[model samples]
Target chain A: MRAHAQLIFWAVLVAALALLPPVVGVLHEPFYVELVRRVMIFAIAAASLNLILGYGGLVSFGHAAYLGIGGYAVGILSFYGMNSGWLQWPVAIGASALVALAIGAVSIRASGMYFIMITLAFTQMLYYLGISIEEFGGDDGMRIKTRSQFSGLIDLADPVASYYLVLVLMFGTIYLVHRIARSRFGMVLRAAKSNEARSRAIGFSPYSYRLCAFTIAGALCGLAGALLANHTAYITPDFMHWTRSGEIMFMVILGGVASSAGPLLGALVLLVFETLLAGWTEHWQVILGPLLVLSVIFFRTGLAGIIPGAGDE
Target chain B: MPPLTLVFEQLLNGVQFGVMLFLMAAGLTLVFGIMNFVNLAHGSFYMIGAYLTLAAVQWSGNYIAGVVLGLAGTLLVGMLVEVVALRTLYARDHLDHVLATFGLILFFNELVAIIWGRTLLDFPRPEWLRGHVEIFAGSRYPFYRAVVILVGLAVGAGLWYVVTRTRLGMLIRAGASNRTMIAALGVNVRLLYTVVFGFGCALAGLAGLMAGPIYAVLPGMGEMILIQVFVVIVIGGLGSIRGAFVGALLVGIVDTLGRAFLRPLLATMISPTAADSAGPALASMLIYLLMALVLAVRPEGLFPSRGR
Candidate 1:
C-alpha cells in the first residue's frame, strides 16, 4: 500500500511539472520556463552534493570549486576559440574530476570539522586564483560570446531547447544517483558514514569508497557548472564562492538529506521562495533567516518527510 | 635603510593583525568548543559591527561614541541570534548548524545591501589619529596604526585577565570542559551560552570598528576575513584561547609578510615574469600551506585543548 502511494505521488509530480509550461502559457507568463530551468540546474548541483554530504557524510564546504572549475573549463576553452561541445564537456568534467582527486587526496584524511575547513581553504585558494587571473577577466568574469556548438546535434542558443536538455540531464542524474545509492558500493559508503570503525571492522576500506564518491560527486557538479556557463553565457569567481557551496548544502537540507528526490524539491522550493520573497520585499532575507532557523529547530525531517508517502523512508 | 625600523613596523603590523584575528577566532572557537556549533555567521556580526559603526558615527557625530554603540548593538544582535536561532541548534548535528548559519549569512548579506547601498562607504579616521609618529630615525608610521596595535594589546590583556582571573572566566572554562556538570551544579547554562555568544559578537564588532578606517566598508566585507579567522582557530587548536592568540599572530605575520615579500624573494629564484605571475597566487596560499603543514605535523594544532 505504501509503495503504491509513493508511485502515485511521483506520477503526480511528473504530470504536474509537464503541465506547467501550458499552464504558464495560459497565464501569459514566459518567465516560468526560465525559472524551471534555473531550478533544474540547482537541483543537479544539489544532487551532486547529496552524494557526498547526505550519503557519504562528507560535509565538503568546497563543492562549489568543482562547479567553478567546470564553468571555467567551458569559459577558458571558448575564450581560446574552442566551441565544440564534445571537447568542452569532456575537458570540463575531466578538470573538475582531477581537482576533486587532488583536494580529496589530502582532505579525505581529515574527518568532521577538519574536513570542512580544509575543503573551504582549498576552494578559497581557487577563488583567489580565479580573481588573480587577468586573462580570465579577474574579478569581473568572462563573457562567452556563444554557447558550445554540438555540430547540428544540439542548438543551445535556444532557451527552450536548452531548458529541455537540462531537464533531461537532471532526470538522468536523479535516476543514476538512486541506482548508485542502492548498490554495493553505496552500502559501503553509507556504512562508513554511519560508523567508520565498524565499516573497517567489516573489511571495507572507507577511504577509497569516500574518495570515489567524492570524485563522482565533483564530476556531476562539474557537469552542472558547464551547463550553467552555457545558460548564462558567462562565468565568474562567484560561481565557486564558498557561499554558493553553502547554498547547495542548504538546498539539500531543506529538501531532506538522504532522500533521492529531496534535493530537487529543496532547490525548487528555495528558488521559488527567493523569487517570490524578493518580489514582495527588499528585505527578503529577514524573512528567510527566521524561516530557516525555525526549519532547523522544528522540522528536522525536512519538507520531503512531511509528504505523507515519503515520511520515514 | 635601517633594519630596526623595518622590523619594528612589521612586528607592530603583525601584532595588530594577529589581535584582530584573535578577536574573530575567539568567538568562533568558543562556540565550536562549548556547543559544538560551526557558526559561519560569526563573520556577519563583524560586518554588522562595521555597518553599525558607520551609522552611529554619522548619526552621533562622534567616532568614539559610534564605536561603543556599535559594539553594544552587535552584542545585542548576537545574543538575540543565539537565543532566537542558535539556541535550538545546540541539540542538533553539525550539518544543521552549517545550514542554519549559512542561511543567516545570506540573510545578513542581503540585509546589509538593502540598508546600505552596495557601494563602499567612506570611513574617515578621526583627527586625533590622523598624524604620523616617528618610531625610529628615517621612518614614520601612521598614528592610527599604532592606536590599533595599542587597542588590540589592551583588549588581549583584558580578555586574558577576564578568562583566567574572574569567576565568569572560570564558568566559561568550566562550560567548555563539561556543560552537563556545570548545568548540574545549578548554573543557568542557557544564560552562560548567551553571554558567551554575545561577548564573542562584541569582539568581532570591535575588530570591525577598528578595521573601518583601515579597510573598505562594503557589503560582504566579512567574507574576505572569515576564512583567515578559521585558519587562525585551526592553527591555534580549536577551543583553546591561547591557541587562538598564537595562531592569529602566526597567520597574520605569515600572510602579511608573504604578500609583501614573496614576489621579491621569488624573483631571485625564478624569472621575473614568472615571479610576477605567481607571486600573488603563492602569497595568498602561504597561510593555507601553513595550515596543511600544521595539520600534517600536529593535527590538534599548536596549542590544542589538552584532552578530548
Candidate 2:
C-alpha cells in the first residue's frame, strides 16, 4: 500500500510541475516561473551529486566545480563567438568530464576524509583559476550577452520557451538517473560503497567503477550547468564557490538521497525556504545555520524519510 | 632591491608565516590524532580569540592583560562547545562532524557580524614591537614580525615538550595508537580528551592574537587561514607535530617565494604583459599545486603517525 502511494505521490508531483507555468500564468505570478527554473537547474545538479554521494558513497565536497566548468564552457565559448547550443553544450559537458576524470584519478587514490579534502583543494584551485582569467571578467565575472541559440527550433530569449526546455531536460535527467541507479553498474557501485574489501574480494576493482561513476555524475552536472547558464543568461566564478557546493550537498541530504526523486524534492524545498526566509529578513542564515545542525542531529534520513509509512528500506 | 637582500628578507617572511601556521596546525593535528575527530570549527576559536583580545585591550588599557584574558576566554569557549555540542558527535562519521561543525561556522560568523558589525577591526602593535630591525645588508625587518616568529617557535618547542616528555603526552600517544587499550587501562579518557581539546583551542587562540596586529581582525578571518593550515597539516602529515612543523615552514617559504618571484620568472619566459596577468594567478595557486604534487607522490603524507 505504501509503495503504491509513493508511486502515486511521484506521479502527481510530475503532473503538477508540468502544469506549473500555466497555473502561475493564470495567477499572474511569472516570478514563480523563474523560481521553479532555478529549482529545476539545481535539481539536476543535486541529482547528479546523489549518484556519487548517496549511492557511490563518495563525499565529494567540491562537486560544484562542474557547475562552474559547465558555466564557463558556455560563457567562454560564447565570448569567442560560438553561441550554438549544439557546440557549446557538448564542449561544456566534455570539459567538465575531463576535469572530473583528472580530479577523480588523483583523489580516488586516497580514501575517506583525505578524498574529501583533496577534492576540495582541486575545486578551490579551479575557483582561483576562474577568477584569474582577466578576459573572463576576472573577479567580477562575465555576463552572457546572448543566450545559446538553439537553431530556431526553440527561442531561448522567450521565457516560456526556455522554461519548457528546462522542464523537459529535468525530466530527461530524472529518467536517466533512475535507470542508472537501478542498473547492474549501480549495484556494483553500491556494493563497493558498502564494502570495498568484500567487493574487491568478489573480483571487482572499486577504482574503475568509482572513477566511472564520478565522471558520469560530473557530465550530468555539466549539462545542468549549461542549462543554468542559459536560464540565468550569466555565469560567474561564484557558481563553483565552496559554499555553493555545500548547499548542493545539503540538498542531497535534505531530499533523503535514497532515490532520484529525492534531490528534486530537496532542491524545491531549499529554494522555497530561502525565498520565504529572505523575504522575512536578511539575517536568515542565523536561523538556517542552527536548523541545519538540528537536522543533521535528528533527521538522519532527511525530508524523504518523514513520509508516512515509508519503511527504512 | 638587491637580489641577495630580497631573498634573505623573503626567507624571514616565509619563516614567520610558517611559524604562525605551526600554531594552528599543532592543535588541529592533536585533535585529529587523539580523538579521531575532524573538527572543522577549530578556526572559530581563532576568530573568537582575536575578538576577545581586541575587546580586552580596549577595556583594560594593558596589552599583556588583554592577551592573557583573550587566550583564557577562547579556551573556555572551546571547552564549553566541546561539552555542549561536539560530545554527541564523537562516534559519528566524518560527514556528520563536517555538517555539524560547518553549521557552527555559519552561526559564529553571523553572530560575530551581528555583534561587531561587518567592518574590519584594526589592531595596532605595541610600541615595543613597532620599529624595524636592521638585520641584513641595509635591509630592515619589522620588530613585530621578529617577535611573532620568536613566540611561535617558543610555543612550538613548548608543545613538543608537553607532547613527548610528559605523562599526559604518553596517554595521548597511547590513546592515538589504541583508544580501547587506554580506556580499558582505566585512564580518564574523557577528561584527557577535554584537556587536549582545550589546549589545542588555546594554541589556535594564541595564533589569532598574534595575527591580530598583522592582519585585520574581522568576521570569517579564521576561515581565510583555515584552508592554508589544512594544507600545512596535509603536507606535514596529519597526526604528526614534526610533520606539521616541517610542512608549515615549507609551505610558508614556497608561498612567499612564489608570490615574490613567480611573475618575474614567468616574464623571462613569456611577454611581460602575459607574465603580469599570470603571475599573481599562478602565485595564488602555488600552494594548492604543491599539495596536489605531495598527495600524488606521498598519499599518506611525509610523516604518518604510528599505525595510521
List pairs with backbone clashes in candidate 1. none
Q: Which stretches of candidate 2 lie over 4 Å from their true place?
A: A308-313
Question: For all the predictions, what are the DockQ values?
Answer: 0.55, 0.66
In the predicted model 2, the residue pairs found to clash are none
lDDT of 2 by residue, B1-308 (tens): 33888889889999998998899999999999999888778888889999998899889988999999999999998888888778788898878887888888888888888888789989988777899999956899999999999999999998889888999999999999989899999998888898899989999999999999988899888877777888887788889999999999998999999889999899989999999899989998899889889989998789877788
What's the C-alpha lDDT at position B162 in model 2? 85
**Model 2 Cα RMSD, 1 decimal:** 1.9
Chain A of model 2 scored by TM-score: 0.97
**lDDT per residue as tens, model 1, B209-263:** 8889988898789878989998887788888888998999999999887877788
lDDT of 2 by residue, A174-219 (tens): 7787788789998889999999999999999999999999999999
Query: Candidate 1: which stretches are off by over 4 Å?
Result: A15-28, A308-313, B1-11
lDDT of 1 by residue, A122-226 (tens): 899899989887778889999999799999887998877788799889988977887787799999999999999999998999989999999999999999999
